[model samples]
Target: MNIEEYRLYCLSKKGVTESIPFSKLPNVLVFKVKGKMFTATDINTFDSFSIKCEPETIEELRLQYDALEEPPYFSKKHWSRVVVDGSISDKILYEWLDISYRLVVAKLTKKERLELEHL
Candidate 1:
């Protein structure tokens, strides 16, 4: 998918907000839920994006998908850089994005999660 499609998909999730938080990398857009980041991508070059992954399954995913690789700026064990080179299908990409969102949501405080549910 293209950048607009990716951005819209992320924004469609409940309580998700987008921001360009890094001054050094102004083109990099981060998508967060309740102020905690779940995924991010460079708007100028939507070739890839980073998403949180379960540490237990990160290695397996990397091994299974050639498009998945170690993220440049995130914990290797908890995040995966997904190359948007069309090697993977959009359906699978959306599923991985959903998993990332859910993982971040699962870590929210009880009150935050409740707030998110109401959004």
Candidate 2:
């Protein structure tokens, strides 16, 4: 999918807020919920999107998908860069995004989760 489609899908998630956390990179869009980031990518050039992932599952994910790779900017153990090439199915990308969102939410404190629920 293209950048607009991807952006819309990411924003559609409940309590998700889009922001550019760094003033130096205004084109980068960080998607977060309850102040915790789940995914992020450059809006100006939709080359890839990085998602927070389970450390144990990263290797398997890299082997399973040709379009996924280690992100240059994120910790290799906790994030995977998913290329926007047409080779990967859009459904799979969305699924991964959902997984990332859930993973971040799962780490939140009970009070944070309760706050997120109301958002």
Candidate 3:
């Protein structure tokens, strides 16, 4: 999928907001709330895209989705960095992104939850 498609998909999720938190990569679009980041990508290039995933399902996803285990940047056991190049279908990619958005939203604080409810 393209950068605009990804941005719209994430924004469609409740409470999620897009920003550029990483100064190093001005083109990198970071999706977050309060302060936590759930997804991010470099709109200028499709080198990498990050998304949150369940710790237990990480390995399974890596096997099922052809994802790689890249840690330090992500939880290694939870989050994943899926390289973009048209290898995967847009439908499946959006589905995974929705899952990541929900997972991140679930961890929001009570105040944050209320704030998001208004949005």
Candidate 4:
């Protein structure tokens, strides 16, 4: 998928926000919910986007898809860097992204979830 499509999809979720929060890399954009990060990528190139993933399934994912890899900057067991190549369809990407988003949302404190509900 294109950068705009990815951005829109992430923003479409409730209480999600995007920002360039990296100090050294000003063009890297991060998507967060309840102040916790879920995804991030290079704003200009869109070469790759990362998401929090279940540690148990990360190994299977990396093996199943050549494009799915451990991000250099994230915990290898809990985050994946999905290369924005045409090999993986947009539909599949969106589904995985939704899963990642929910995983992060699920980890939020009860009060944080209630706060997100009001957003």
**Alpha-carbon lDDT, every model:** 0.96, 0.91, 0.79, 0.93
How much does each candidate deviate from the true structure in C-alpha RMSD? 0.6, 1.1, 1.8, 0.9
Q: Please write out the lDDT profile of model 3 over residues 7-114, one tens digit for every residue.
A: 888888776778887787788789986567888887888666888888877887788766444644666777888877677788878877887877887898888888
lDDT of 4 by residue, 73-100 (tens): 9999889999998899999899989988
Clash number for candidate 4: 0
lDDT, candidate 1, 14-47, per-residue tens: 9999999999999999999999999999998899
Error of 1 at 74 (Å): 0.5
* Best model number under TM-score: 1
Choose the strongest candidate by lDDT. 1
Model 3 Cα shift for residue 76 (angstroms): 0.9
Model 3: how far is 46 from its true place, Å? 2.1
> Model 1 off-target regions past 4 Å?
none
Flag regions of model 4 displaced more than 4 Å: none
- Writing each residue's lDDT as its tens digit, candidate 2 over 9-54 gives 9889888999999899889899998889999999888999999888
Error of 3 at 57 (Å): 0.7
Question: Which model is ahead, 2 or 4, in terms of lDDT?
Answer: 4
Instruction: Specify the poorest-scoring 10-residue window by lDDT in model 1.
Output: 110-119
Q: What residue runs in model 3 are displaced by over 4 Å at the alpha carbon?
A: 67-72
